[model samples]
Target: MARDNKAMISGFRCLCAFIFVISACSIASFLYSCQCTSPCHDPGREWGQSLTPNQTIDLLSFPEAWNNLNFPQVPPPWRMKIAVFVKKWPHRSQAGGLERHALTLHLELAKRGHEIHIFTTSPINASSFPKYPFPNLHFHLSKPTAAGYLDQSTVWDQFQAQNSSGSPRRPFDVVHTESVGLMHTRSRKLTNLAVSWHGIAYETIHSDIIQELLRSPEEPQAYSLTERAVKVVEEVKFFRSYAHHVATSDHVGDVLKRVYMIPEERVHVILNGVDEEIFRSDFKAGKNFRRNFGIPKSKTLVLGIAGRLVKDKGHPLMFEALKQMIRENAKFRETAIVLVAGDGPWGSRYRGLGSNNVLVLGPLEQAQLARFYNAIDIFINPTLRAQGLDHTLLEAMLCGKPVLATRLASITGSVIVNGNVGYTFPPTLELLKRALYRVWSDGRGVLEKKGEVARQRGLQFFSATKMAAAYERLFLCISSMSGGDTENQCQFEDSSR
Candidate 1:
């Protein structure tokens, strides 16, 4: 009996030591991820956070070496180059949604051994883009055209001088343009051309501007008028040359097809995705984040919002809902709190209101923002309207938060109305109030269940791996278009309702 007891004690000691080693390594890995300042880690993390993969696997983990972070069995590094043309880049002060997406796509391509050149107009706001973390990425300031635009020939000539001294100039493996109104060149001259439409084109703006101009008497505005007209013509001509078109959302895809008569086969949809390896909730972080925000532990209730604090994002709607909730029941005032993440034109205005319940955390990097997801019982995306799928909502979902999204065109009611994940509402205060009440009544149970469902859905349909694979296939198919005149101006009747 004495010998058996000694053996059991020794076994326990060994098990404890193994657990200690795992705990120590896990903590160290988390600290490393938290300290990472790569543009990839730019804007989100809740304080002192760490990441753990689904099975604690290091495959595609955060804080990874660039070359090691990619899909399993990814194509061997190929000698390919693609240029991403955009009007602005992040940190250039012109930082907006477009710039963020540009960085994201560039980073993804660079990981795949594709040389990426980020070309942009002379930023209106001096873009102090963070020093790129990846060794393979490059940026160039294209010589401006006569009108100071990044027209096709402007970039083509910029590359012309650098051409290899050999027979048949090596055509670019791909020319990818986004947001910028890409100037189309002739099909035979170019091998691979792609345009990523963020939303309705500058031509959409042109039609509206032209109508407004014609309404008023031409006040010697002929020079500016004629110049804009010429630019529009060039843009249309340029678009016809795009062999492959990409859109971030179905709404934008529909707009492109209707506005430019693009075909369904030619346009590809690549939804923006969150980096889950960074955004996963510290399932253990419950209550800690709430305490840091000074909320009492008794109430399992807090409202959360993230994104630009602009009117279009529906900040006022949230304000109205709060007022209604306060008036409806004095009890809710004690239980509810709202934490707004992100800063923009209206952030100051909301701060000025000085509501006791609203905590405005201006803007946070990606991983830091995950804590806000950790802190709150519910997430609200009251965008009155949106041009594309609000990726903020997707991130919230990834973090296991139940979303309260508006029934907007981009986030169709059908897509978000799954009872287990979130609730959809028309842009009305009453509807918002009702939704909040339902969420608050049994908030914890409802949110937990919905969060599980969200994780499953995201894994199955919305992962970066899935999105990248889709694009890979799309790229392969587009590169094979050797015949058929893709520029035939047949009027496109959009069937993508």
Candidate 2:
């Protein structure tokens, strides 16, 4: 009986040891699986951080070296040499919307591992633009003529010389130029040339003419008559010089096909993008930004406008509508303030109309402008031009501020929906006043909700990442088609749009 009991105890001990071993194996497997999945899944990080010596040697042949910072998933590097031409670069002073558009899009492309060469005339405000430095990027500045214009031939000649070298070492896969870059557009060497149209210059001239008619005849002309006439002729010739065109909006695309007679197949619509990283919602930032400008916290609403403060920008119309609103309503005069962020000849003309309600804080740099957008409750774009949507609208919307723009087809045709992101009013004073009163009476919470919706839309549709990807795809598509193959011409349009 004693021997049998001892044997039973030994059997129980063996069973207990088996159970402990199984649990240990299970825990070890679980931890091994988690480590396998968690630590090395990031593609950018893997490329940047864990390259072998041979891989490092391969990557070193290219200009973009692997860095520790993990970037968003970018396209497989095409490693193509690309040349870009712009009338003005956003380096010196306050760049116009077009210049900013070019800079932002190109910089994003550079980050994605393309070799980029920028050719431009020296900025008019050289003091404001120091030398810009970027890895895998080169800038060639052409000296301006005594007449304060970049001589197109000088740039064209340099481009030709570089491209004609026939050395595989200096091969350029594509050339990109702005709409105003007439000489570059005429390049015969690269069939893969593209022109980006920010706005139709003829339409701009027409709008400026109408604004001039509204001004007093005694007021000096905005430009000498010869300069005005010369600009019109230049625009006509430039559009006729047709290359593949990129229009920043559907409205601009329509204008390209209809007014400019660009072939539908030749024109691609790629909307302008905003840097979502910079222009994002910050409730706490609002008070700080306003405080910097001496605006009181008690002010119920702030209406902000950022762009050139010129007649063609529809500042006069905006002032007329605001004055009429103030005269008709007392609450608007007391509760709301207008912050104009730009500089132009029209700044001093309508300074005293608002009785201290309007504050024109001249041209702001991009960083200050981001803060300015955050400070405002709503953005008002009263532009009366037939020109396409402005970049300011996207920037404001990205910052979670709903935009109230004039209901021109140009503004209406973009991503903005009436009463969803913001409201749009007719250019008429009565309509503007009605829109203003509606926002004023509904309270700030209503606007804040709409601003949230605007931000969501901006994230989905107008991000710089998406924009750069679209352009890259288009460039690749065009490069492929330039090789005696026209079958895939529409291959990237859907992806880009």
Candidate 3:
């Protein structure tokens, strides 16, 4: 039976590889035709306007005004009709990092008066659509599959009907896909469309390698290295279908440009952001939360790990490190307690460590997440996945808590810019143990100071306002190419650039 199963898996892989090669060859001509005919490809065209060196820098780099920490909200110069394509809308019960990002970013955009249309899969419960506070925001739901994935064809059909239905035929100024409109983009090319990539195939390949290395000898590998390499090639080819790309991290932007061969001008980096109002520092709230949970004041160093507890999230490493810390160091067993948030298979395993050592909080709503962040001394994200930036780290930082996370490029380059904000270690048992020990030795006072720095950094770079402004700027730039009024153009320039 085992031999037969192995043979079937091998056959499937071979079939997939063959299909990918054929698809790549088939799309080569289509991609070439797009480049030749697309206005975005012509350097002399309006969409391809030559930006001044300073304007180019401003578009690419983080603005200096953001460092002030009191940077005022600047409304967009003009409102727009934005079509958003995402897999799911965030609900109180079920919101992942991507869902939270879509909610935060588009809400801010809608608040600034953009007419937003969200096209997504139907809610889990048909009768319970999420209600938002924004007036101009509208939703178009496509029936989901049994497994809850989006029906891409239905979504695209809905978008087409809406795009051409109005009396004067109102068209969307710009189309934004949260990595869900690939099929539509592939079906027909649209110059004004921009796709935001949370994670790409190259990153997934790296994640696969990390997972395989971290897996126990008793476990079987999910995909061999060759299979992952084949998938990467397939993904990179498909990625070229979209004219513009939004990379969620600096590292991802670099990968899109260098590894996937996306043009530098077509790739934009906009780091993920959190809600500042909700995740702000509140000592009283933290104290109240600790008390409500019956945590004693003597527990000086409270460690937290949020998000899904699956093995790919690096929970195995965290479990091993925490277990070792509790067993070896008597001080940790007494002075520290680990709070595990979110739900997955590893929750029971964490509980097996004893309730006294690890407190399993399961999944939390946004408000509860704010309290959870404040109640802890430091946030630990031992994620092995090196794809998108994790929002929990930013949320914790916004709440004035330092982070101890894996030394992935996304975290190190974007999240933890300096050593003072937090600690980072390679995703290994020994290194993670050493990092935990160091945090233990530093005590709560040192962590508090680091948390303060982290708060400022989070406000400067990871605030919803900053993220919204950057995206609005990109939208304006893309929309202007289609001959909007001069007043609609992006006129705001940063001299500091």
Candidate that would win on TM-score: 3
RMSD of 1: 23.2
How would you order the candidates by TM-score, starting with the best? 3, 2, 1
Better of 2 and 3 by lDDT: 3
Candidate 3: where are CA atoms >4 Å away? 1-72, 165-169, 182-188, 484-492
* Backbone Cα, N, C clashes tallied per candidate: 15, 0, 0
Task: Give the CA lDDT, 0 to 100, for residue 214 in model 2.
Answer: 62
TM-score of 3: 0.85
What digit string (tens of lDDT, one per residue) describes model 3 on residues 243-262?
67888876677667656887
Give per-model TM-scores: 0.68, 0.76, 0.85
Worst 10 residues of 2 by lDDT: 59-68
For model 1, the stretches where C-alpha displacement exceeds 4 angstroms are: 1-73, 76-79, 92-94, 121-127, 142-156, 159-170, 184-191, 201-241, 254-260, 285-287, 352-355, 413-417, 482-497
Look at candidate 3 and tell me the lDDT of residue 329.
86
Provide the global lDDT of candidate 1 against the true structure. 0.59
Of 1 and 2, which scores higher on TM-score?
2
